[model samples]
Target: MSVWDGIVGQEPTVNLLKSVVASPGSGRDDIAQSWLICGPPGSGRSNLARAFAAALISPDQGLSDQPTRVTSQVLAGSHPDVTILSTNKVTIGIDQVRDLIVTSEQMPTTAPWRVIIIEDVDRMLERTTNVLLKEIEEPAPHTIWLLCAPSAQDVLPTIRSRTRVVNLAVPSNTAVADFLIRQEGVDRATALKAARLAQGHIGVARLYATDRQVLADRDELVIGLLGLRRSSDAIILAGRMVDDAKSQAARAVEGQVARAESEFRQVNGLGTDERIPPALRGAYHALGGKDEVRRRTTRLTRDVLDRYLNILASVYRDVCVLQNQADETAGLVNLENRPAITDLSVRLTRRAAIDRLETIATARRRLAGNGSPLLVFEALFCRLLVSDR
Candidate 1:
């Protein structure tokens, strides 16, 4: 398949990138070296970046004779000349940027250009962005950087000014559903529900279609939120949400950390329970990569919490739609939760639903600012309780 085949609803972007890849030096200078791909969550920013990388590494021969091996290798991240830095951490540290900068200085070993992709560039701290500024501004002639962020504004203005911007919009529900049906062999009904529920997020729609448990959990969360009839119930539900998020986050990373630790021990010639003697402890610690693991865990936990909040927010949004008798054309994010939405709309005033949504937004802001999730959710629950009453 072509590198651009799977990217939905980005025909113009695909065409632009394809032309550049076909005749690299013929494109506008602005589109050559450094690119900032901006899109909302699930808009396939990273997918587009990888596609461009694949096309870049493929033989310069015409698109008809594209090197499938190079494209596959780039997609699978096995390409020696293409490096991807995708972090689950809260911030990309200065050390990470420095290492990437060092990599960028090296000439391409095999491909025509050395491509470095940094996904979620918005997650990098201001100081870390500053550290990367000079390297991105003055990269080696053979080096290219592809950075992905939710928006151009999310990146520092100086960095934003230096990179060519590619913006991707959310795909239509029909496009998402068609993709699921064609790619994953999902039935049309299931695909439509998943696509509608995911609000055009292809990844999430696939998950909703393939994972029955995810669909069930979303239903439970939506129904439970709507049925919160008392303050104690709100508090209990809030705690459950936080606990569930933490548990999911821990489960998500537990196996990854175990594998990393096992590989670290094997490389160090140590048993699972072995402890290094004082003299060799420095080497052992150096191999641990413990700080990186902890950082990933923290970041994953926060992300899971954010996802939980997003689900709640979607349910409330559905409530708003139902309360206003919004037309089907407006669409519902939680399509499967329509019964719950309708019930809540009838049982609660429109103002209460709006207030609850506001409370959730405030909780998200507090969480973003690194406030304690428990306190933030507790306050949110209190506010929601008061509003419902």
Candidate 2:
């Protein structure tokens, strides 16, 4: 099967990329030398980018090479010919932009075209983006840039002006389920369940389908949040969340780091049985970078866990609202925890429920500002306990 077939529910986008690859000179139609693929998280933006790259580097439909009009290469790395700039850390930094600039000036090694794919373009700090603006404005011949972001608004006005924008929408639930089941060997029932729970996020859907532990973790977090009673309880829960974040981060990084270190050793000319060579200094540098990435990822994961906690609190607030006989249309949908939600809703006033929601919102903002998760939860839980009392 062709690589394009893997991109489910993106028939229109697939057609567009195929047309560009099929064109006489790879669609050098305009001076606009870049394209933006924007969509929500897990909407397969990166998958589309990779597929397009594959098509550009090897556009040979039936193995007849006449320098096939469409030949694409896998520039999924920092290669001299085709560069892909992505964050090795949680946020893309200025140094990455500097590297891209240096790479952009180099001549292509083999192909007539040089392509750069920058995933999470929105993560670039303002100063870094400014550094990139000049190169983007006047790209070298045979150079093409592709940027992927969660939405158009995340990109700078200057960058947006110079690029052709492509919007990607979320696939339907049925489509997501079908893709998981057919491609990933997931059972139909499991795929469908994950598709529903993921809310159109393909990555999250896959995690749900394959990882029982992840599902259990989320469920436990939600259930624990519903059981909160006192301010002290909230404080303790927040501490547990922070610890859990660190533990999970370490667990996730262990295997990946080991594999990356082994690959680096191989690339640096070190034999499998030999100790790390002194000349392989650059490889060690890359390993250091990977560790930094792990640290940042840990923080981000912790923040995400805290955010889910807030969502749980919000659900409780909604239950409190329902208890006061508030408008049902405005109630939060906590179908899975319906009994608990119903009980809570019956016990609180609409005003009290709204107050709790306001508290949760404040906690969310505080978390964004790097506030102590423990402190925020303590305050929220105290208020909850008092209001209930």
Candidate 3:
């Protein structure tokens, strides 16, 4: 299979990347050492980066004897020349950038190019992003940096101005549904439902199609929003959302935390019940501190809340779509919740629905600023309650 086979949709992006890979170092300065892959969430920016890395690393481009094997190794993250820095945490720290900068100065171990792929570059703090600016702007002859972000606006002007930008379009619902059927063996009906609900996000569509708990949680959130009546109800629902986000984050990281603790104990030669030696206490604390655990959990909780906000936004978006009687051919993201959407459309005007969407957007911005989700969501729901009435 070709290096780009796994990427669904994005034909233009695939062709452009393939051309660059096929004719690397032919004096085509447009394909620079640093590239920014910009797209919405779930547009497969990371996937595209990995595929390009595979093609660059392979001796024969896309015609290697084991092209599929090369691509698989890159995707599985076993390729030595291809370095991927991806994190589930809320921010990418400066320390991480320092380590990658060290690698960037080195020569390739095996492949012709040493490719560094940083997923979610938008999550890096301004200081952390500045650390890599010089390296990305003036990398070694064989070094290439691939940075992925949700949009161009998320990146700093200095960094963006020095890099080549590759924009990726979100896959249509029909495209996403077909991909699920071919890849995950999903039934057409379920695939279509998941695709529409996911709103062009392939990962979310797959989860919504396969995971019953996710489906149930989405239904509950939408229905709960529809049933909000009074300020008291909004306050109560806000608490529930905060609680749910916390629980979801905790569940996601419980396994990783357990494994980390186990590894730390093993490396430090301490048993579960053993007390730390007085001399080694500092090392132990540094390796497995409760503060670190709390920080990681907080980041995960914020990320979960971000996802919840996106889902919440989709509800109002669907309501607005129904109120306007938008294109008949295009389906709603929350098609399963059409009855509730119809009811909301009848009760609230299109302008009210638009205002509700804006409230959700404001809530997201507040949450990103380290504000409490409980308070932000409470205020948002109260505003939405007024709009609904």
Candidate 4:
């Protein structure tokens, strides 16, 4: 199968990268060593970047013709000439950027070129990006940088101008559903419903299709928000919402940290729960042992909070659609909650639903900007309280 398989609805960007591989130097932009791939969440920017890296590293220089061994190596990010950096932290710091700069200067060891693929490049600190700008302005001949971000505007304009930017489109519901069917083996009915609810995010669509608990949790969050009748109840429920998200984020990363620590312990011939000597511990903390985990947990917590806010917004979004549309069945994101959404729509004006959506959006931005989660949600929940009058 082609490396691009399962990357839903990004044909133009895929073809552009393929052409770059097959016929380099045809255009200055075509073979540019540094490139930016930008798209919304679930647009497969990382997938495309890795696939392009694989094709570029392969001798055949084509997606379909890339040898299985070479393809697997690049995809797994184990290829000697390729470097992949993906951080779960909130921001990529100066030290990480400096290390990447050093790697970028190295000559290719085996493949014709050295490829570095960094996900979430926009999350790099501005100071760190300034440091990276010097190297990007004069990158080595055999080095190629593929940076993935949500948008060009997310990074500094100086960095944006230095790299060729490729934008990916959000896949359609039909395309997403089709991918679910082919990849996840879900039935067409489940696929379509999940695709609609996920709002064009392939990753979210997959979770919606495959996991019953996701839908249940989403329903609970949506219903809890809508059922708030008193200001006191809203504030109380808000606390629970914050706790739920933080808990989920904690559970999600605990295993990753555990596995990594286990492997490191095994390599150092230490048993599980064994304390290390002070000298050896230096190396461990230097590699971001406890500090990095704290940062990752914070980031994951914000991610879960964002998802909670998004799910709440979807309910109002459906409410707004039902209030405005000629046909109530069309254009609803949360089809599973139609009965409640329909009832809520009848109780509130269209303006009220829109206002609540705006409130949720504000909470989301505040959370991302490092606002205290409990306070933000408390304020948001109180504001979202529907009046009986």
Candidate 3 lDDT by residue in tens digits, 1-389: 67677787898999887788767443335357999999998899999999888877776575454566666788778888889999867789899999999998899898778899999999998999899999989988889999999999999999999999999999988889998998889999999988888888888888788877777777878888888889998999889888887877666567666776677688787899888789877866664467776777798889778878888888888777777788375557777678877888889877877888888888888998989788988998888884434
Task: Flag regions of model 2 displaced more than 4 Å.
Answer: 6-8, 30-32, 61-80, 88-91, 262-297, 303-335, 342-365, 376-389
Q: State the lDDT at 353 in candidate 3.
A: 78
Single out the weakest 10-residue window by summed lDDT for candidate 1: 59-68
Can you write out model 1's per-residue Cα lDDT over 1-389, one digit (the tens) per residue?
57787898788898888877776453335346999999988889999999899887777422443547778888877798999998766678789889999999998898878999999999898899999898788878888999999999999999999998999988988888988998999899999888888887778888789878667767766677767678788778778777776765666567676776687678778898998668767755554366765666677778767767878888778878877778475767876667767777776787878887888888888998999987887777667653433
Kindly report which residue pairs in candidate 2 clash with one another.
56-71, 56-72, 57-71, 57-72, 57-73, 58-72, 319-345, 323-345, 323-346
Q: Write the candidate numbers in order of decreasing lDDT.
A: 3, 4, 1, 2
Q: Which lDDT tens digits does candidate 4 get at residues 80-107?
A: 8889899877788889888888988888
Top-TM-score structure, candidate number: 4
On residues 224-339, what C-alpha lDDT tens digit does candidate 2 reach at each position? 66687766776777677666656655665665667777877777767767776667767676665866766756675655555465446657655765665563655443457767
- The C-alpha TM-scores of every prediction are 0.84, 0.78, 0.85, 0.86
Kindly report which residue stretches of model 3 are placed more than 4 angstroms away from their true locations once superposed: 24-31, 60-69, 255-296, 327-329, 386-389
274 Cα displacement, candidate 4 (Å)? 16
How much lDDT does each candidate structure score?
A: 0.80, 0.70, 0.83, 0.83
Off by over 4 Å in 4: 24-30, 65-67, 255-295, 326-330
Q: lDDT score of model 2?
A: 0.70
| Deviating ranges (above 4 Å) for candidate 1 | 24-31, 60-67, 254-297, 346-352, 386-389
- Model 2 TM-score is 0.78
